[model samples]
Target: MKMGWRELIRMKQRFTLMAIVTTLIVLLILMISGLADGLAYDNGAVVRNLPVEHVALSQDAEGQLTRSFLEQTDQPAGTEALGVQSMVLEKQNGTKDDVTVFASPVDTVYGPKELATLKPGQVLVDTQYAKQSGTAVGDTITDFRTKATFEIVGTVSDGRYSHAPVLWTTLETWKAWQDKMKTNYVSAFISQDPIKTDLATYTQQQIVEQVPGYAAEQNSFQMMRIALVLIGSLILTAFFYILTMQKMKQLGILKAIGIRTRTIGQGLVLQVFLLTTVSFAISLLLIWTIGQLLPGDLPFRFEWTTSFGYGGLIVLTAMLGGLIPLRALKKLEPADAMGGMTG
Candidate 1:
């Protein structure tokens, strides 16, 4: 492997160019993949991570939270019905603060803040919002519509829905400000199993698919992923073919010397593996450096699984690229190298 690497480095100019090109492509796709994952998490993480068993959305709501309310049927049998509530919230000092308020039961999950630090005059906001808004532990924020002021209680680390910041307030708070009455648009409910013994259980994927924006948002990202994959295949194919053609004489010379095509093929595949390994390593480093330079809002985050997954893809792409040259090798007629200029 070390020898193979040295050979690649020996052809510095050509290998450098190819490596750089491939590295950039890999970096872009991987970063895009990360961003897509980030968006997905941003859209659903808080809700998904909650310690709830099931989510309840009105059958009439058509899976869209904004347009749907919770029907009585959607509510858990044991749970009591709470009137509608909404709040007008804006980020502190932000020209246009974007915060979401949910109508929740005053007792169950969305009830009053669990922390002693939080009081009735205020609500809990996701940590992201507090960081973005520069709001402190306690600050007075106006409910624009109600013309009332609400205090910011202790910060909560987990609170984001549909990729937007969220604020947790009582059902009555929503009603006092938003004028929502007997509305079922409670959107969805989270509960542990033994789920009222009446409601059916649906996986998160099933539930998310039912969400109005879920399919569209996910579809768009999938399309982007598909496009990048195709481009990767093309680039790899083109580069490897060109690299093989440039080394055609070398191949002929090796063939003439009793070097089996198998040996040459192995060498080429090895070369590609080495190239992709180095390129991907560099690309990962680049992404980390770039991430440090960007602001918090930039949507580019991924778990270790994502990087490992992309690395496998990079290797696969390189192998496919190297495979393209094999076809050209089979086409080589040993006689051509006898004494002729070839393109």
Candidate 2:
């Protein structure tokens, strides 16, 4: 470890360049990770925040809540059918914004904290909508389609669907707004326990995929993230290999002077470990600072678990990169290596 530090200090310019490059790559990776998570949260926060473990959709709906038509008779015991529809909410100033309206039974317990029974003409809206539209509790919001107005009684976090903020209403009010009777139908059923009914059941992940454009967007972002990881690994490997080649003569001289090959290998691994650790720390700090400065509406989210997970991956890949050049060191003869002979 001392030798590794000495070597890095001796070749400060070269090692500094490598560290900067590694930091940039890691920063890009963290940013992309945040973006991916942000998009996922924006599109599926409502369903993800549900207390239910499984959602039962009509078999014929093909796993889509919007397409499902479930009635009270179809739901099992302890399950409440919910109605979901996308609509525009008009502000007093006539500014209309898209929102997903969710109508659940008054006693349903499948929403975020602070969620409770909704009375007629009263609604709970996502905090995002409140921030965007500058509406608060006691403010009235009108539906563009039915021209019905509801008082905003409270706010819920993580309440969004397909990138739209969600508004919670009573099942009776929702049916009335849609010009349907109470017995008409609901989109799906939410339950914490598993249901063995013939209807189609979907886990939270599956439900997220059912959101419009959610699957495709997430797939694209994930593929890009994977590509970035592969590219970063390759670059690190190549850099370390080149650095190793430059130090081969020194390594051979040390070996000739009784330094064990294992010791040399450990030194190289230590250098990579140090470089990756420092670079990852700096990158995370930069990300945190930038995240703090970013506006709330940018749809960017950062999680400590994700940062640690990616940092671990970077360290592992960088260490693996260092190990790739060890084969060359093992094959080198002290005489030939010192003499600068390739063979």
Candidate 3:
């Protein structure tokens, strides 16, 4: 390790260039990872935050809450009915915005205390939607289709569904609106107990993934991340291989002087570790700073767990890349080492 540090300091310019390349690659990976999480949250925050382990949807709905419809009798006795309606909200300025109305008993939603006390004609909205529409407590917004007005009672954080803001109200309020629309079915059944009905049942995570565009978007991001990692590994391999080629003559001289092949390999591994660690730290700092400057409404979430998780992968890849150069080192004979001196 000591010799590796000395050699790195001696070739600081070359190593710095390599570190910069790795850092940029890691930055891209972290940015994409954060965007993936943010998009997933935006697409299905409501289902992800439901306070239930299992959800039962009508067999025809195929795990989708919005499309599922179950008559009160169809809901299993042990489960509670949850109503989900995709509707447009007409702001006070007469502009319309997309919203999903969730009608469930307050205890079923993992939301603010204000949600539990909601009465008929009053609703809680997603905080993001409230900010975008300038809707606040005591403001009245109308349902564009039904023309029914609801007073905004409060705002709940992370309340979204199918990329639309969610508005929370009681089942009774939903039933009143349904009477006007002549519809008579809840969206799904939700419970901590396993749902044993003939309907399609899914875990909360499965339900979240079924949200429109959720699974496709996440799969796309995952593919991009995999491509980036592969590209990065190749780049590291090429860099180290070229560096090893350049140092072959010097490595021969060290071998001729009785340096053990294992010691030489240790130095190379140590260098890879140091370089990857520095690159990861720099990338992490850059991503954090970028996150701070971005708009709150932008779909980007940077979590420490994700950054560190990717950092570990990067280090592992770097180690693998360094191994290719070690093979060349192991095959270098003392006669070949002295041949470089003679030539």
Q: Clash number for every model?
A: 12, 0, 0
lDDT, residue 65, model 1: 47
Clashes of 1: 12
CA lDDT, every model vs. true structure: 0.66, 0.85, 0.86
Q: Can you rank all candidates by lDDT, best first?
A: 3, 2, 1
* Cα TM-score per model: 0.81, 0.88, 0.91
TM-score, cand. 1 = 0.81
Candidate 1 has its poorest 10 consecutive residues by lDDT at 78-87
Per-residue CA lDDT of model 1 for 226-343, tens digit only, reads 6876787688778878878877887788787787777777778888887788888888888777767877676667556777687777678768777878877877766575456455
Q: Best lDDT goes to which candidate?
A: 3
Task: Compose the digit string of candidate 3's lDDT tens values, residues 1-343.
Answer: 6778899999999999999999999999999999998888878888777777998888899788888988988778788888998888888888899899988776654444565788888888889888887888999888888898888888878568988989988887889888878898899888888988888999999989899998889999999988998899889988988888788878887888888888888898898899989999999999999999999889888899988998889889988988998888899876675564353
CA deviation > 4 Å runs, candidate 1: 1-6, 71-98, 103-121, 134-138, 145-149, 172-185, 194-201, 205-212, 340-343
Superpose all Cα atoms of candidate 2 onto the true structure and report the RMSD in Å to 1 decimal.
3.0
The list of candidate 3 runs beyond 4 A from truth reads: 106-116, 333-343
